[model samples]
Target: MINICFKQSSSKILGFNIEGHAEYGEEGEDIVCSAVSALSYTIVNGITEVLKISVEHIIKDGFLQLSLRDNNLEEIEKCQVLLETMLLGFKSMEIGYGDYIKVQVEEV
Candidate 1:
């Protein structure tokens, strides 16, 4: 299963941690995993390249973690839309593939 946890402070998103694989199909044909990866990379690129915000991230097999490098509320706010969109995508996936994915939100 793919486990995703979003961390927030004062109702603002701070970052997220995602680990595991859907294992719903053969590696290359796992649509769940592919969707997750595409959304993740899009948000990462949107924040780091488009928004020009510094971020701390770790990418590895079946794992991806990302956090705003600075805690500045304004900077963090800039990422909300993209992050929230990612959340929506994940939630939608969970609805369809509950057996393969889990989503959680945590107050930090």
Candidate 2:
């Protein structure tokens, strides 16, 4: 499962925190983690450029967490769309059979 939280500091600004989890066969756990990490990296890298913001920090554990700071509604909205696309792509990947993953988003 993946849970993403967004915090808006202003009308045109917000931050995101992402957490993801997967239930995969033992041999495929690493692949699951790698896929999730890659998705997070793509999101942060893409948003940083699209929004012209800096990624303050990123942490990985059972899930991944990304924090960014930006003040552009247009960019933020674009980022949101990109994030959704990435998540959907990850969901569609067949890295492991009988594995399950989920993504969620929230405004904080």
Candidate 3:
């Protein structure tokens, strides 16, 4: 299962961590995995590219993370929309692929 977790700080989304695979099908054929991957990558790109936020993150085999290094309230608040949109996408996937994905939000 893919574990999708959001880290929050004082009502703001600091970042998100994604790990594991959906295992819904073979790698290239897994719709669940593909959807999640697309959403995750879009989140990283959208924030950095469109919002111009500098993200501190890690990317590796079966894992991807994204977060902001800037703690300014305005920047964090700006990121909230993108992060919450990502979470909603993940939740939509979870609803469809209940056996293949799990979502969580954690306070940091």
Which candidate leads the pack in TM-score? 1
In order of appearance, the predictions have TM-scores of: 0.96, 0.55, 0.93
The CA lDDT of each predicted structure is: 0.93, 0.56, 0.87
Tell me the tens digit of each residue's lDDT in model 2 across 31-106: 6656666876777777677566655666767645554453345555666666566655654653342345543344
Best by lDDT: 1
For candidate 2, the per-residue lDDT at 96 reads: 41
Cα RMSD of all models vs. native, in order, equals 0.9, 4.7, 1.2
Which of 1 and 3 is ahead in lDDT? 1
| Per-residue lDDT of model 3, residues 1-108, tens digit only | 999999987877898899999899997999998898888898888888999978788988789988764557787888888899998988888888999999999998
Find the 10 residues in a row with the least total lDDT in model 3. 66-75
Angstrom error of the Cα, residue 36, model 1: value is: 0.4
lDDT of 1 by residue, 1-108 (tens): 999999988777899999999999998999999999999999999999999988899999999999874658888999999999999999999999999999999998
